[model samples]
Target: MKRMLSLVVTTAALLLALPASAQFAKPEDAIKYRKSALTVMGTHWARLAGMAQGRIPYDAKAAADNAAVLEVAHKLPWAAFGADTQSGDTKAKSEIWKEPAKFKEAEERLFAEVPKIVAAARSGKQDDLKAAFAAGGGVCKNCHDNFRQ
Candidate 1:
């Protein structure tokens, strides 16, 4: 009984030490993770865009908070695009796996532009924030047109 207890404790510790990606037992889990991350990123991006486009009254603090959320959320979904995740309930196109270089380039473009948007939001200039937000949206559109369903 003592030997069994020791083995169980060791297994639990090993599992806990695994990387987050390594903990996914099914491709569906990765798909779900990426989808959830994209949803959150979209929510934040929409809020920022509303302010930039004048649809929503611009609050400097709210803009900054939303942009900060975008900065972090944009970095999350990419890691979940592991092998076999493409077969699940993801809108990610097969081009992501077939033309990985192109897909990565598109992803990199958004990552690069998001920081500029964040900076603009923190700059307290509405014009700069609007321009940056539009640019970031363009990057997102390009990637979606190419890589997403």
Candidate 2:
């Protein structure tokens, strides 16, 4: 019994010390923190999109839950991308600052995509949802391709 108690205490201590984002910190730990959080957001988004697209069937509660997470995480990764942070582990390019208008458009596209995904998930329809998510992802990919390395 004493041994078991010690093991349990050790496990709890370790779990408290190690956050989910621990593996993803960059040198300054900005983008890494956001991306780690974003990854959590993305996992749900992919599931809902897959279901919405018909790879899996719609699960209403799941859609709601995942949508909730994605809504926030969608906005996080961009905050860390200031002019001072133009290097290392980022998909961001110098063009982000150079062609501000185009970058803004890309950002807008992603913003637009998230709401639609949420709407579709809320509507509880599987049909055409996958395509919607893929289109949203395209916005993300477009930005990442151009800006992030």
Candidate 3:
């Protein structure tokens, strides 16, 4: 039994370490990757919020796990907008490039909010998580709606 348990633990660790995708090799690639990650992350995050809010059923653990995904996903959006990063399938608006300062300011706002969402999600505090998730998620949507293609 102990040997079997050890094997299971080893397998789980290996699976967790699997790389999700190719690393960005250039600035443009990085931007493209970040945009993609943001969208995918946003989709999952929205579903997570729904679950947390009981727009779907409440699943505390699931919500917490989804929050973990956001922790990384949340970091990519702004990084993708760097001068070297551009030309992608994203809905990212030219305004991001046109007004670097303002665009970065918006990104800053998002960065500021994401940790709070992660915290609330981790806390398993339903209401707090929901509120933070809404705000953090909103930042993403707002940016996508305006700047992303």
Q: Which predicted model would earn the best lDDT?
A: 1
Q: lDDT scores for all predictions?
A: 0.86, 0.72, 0.71
Ordered by lDDT, highest first, the candidates read: 1, 2, 3
Clashing pairs in 3: 91-148, 91-149, 92-148, 92-149, 93-147
Model with the higher TM-score, candidate 1 or 2 = 1
| Candidate 3 accuracy as lDDT | 0.71
Candidate 2's C-alpha runs over 4 A off are 1-27, 134-137
CA shift of 117, model 2, Å: 0.9
- Candidate 3's C-alpha runs over 4 A off are 1-28, 84-88, 134-137
lDDT of 2 at 149: 62
- Cα RMSD (angstroms) for every candidate in the order listed: 5.9, 8.5, 7.4
TM-score of each: 0.83, 0.69, 0.69
For model 2, what is the C-alpha lDDT against the true structure? 0.72
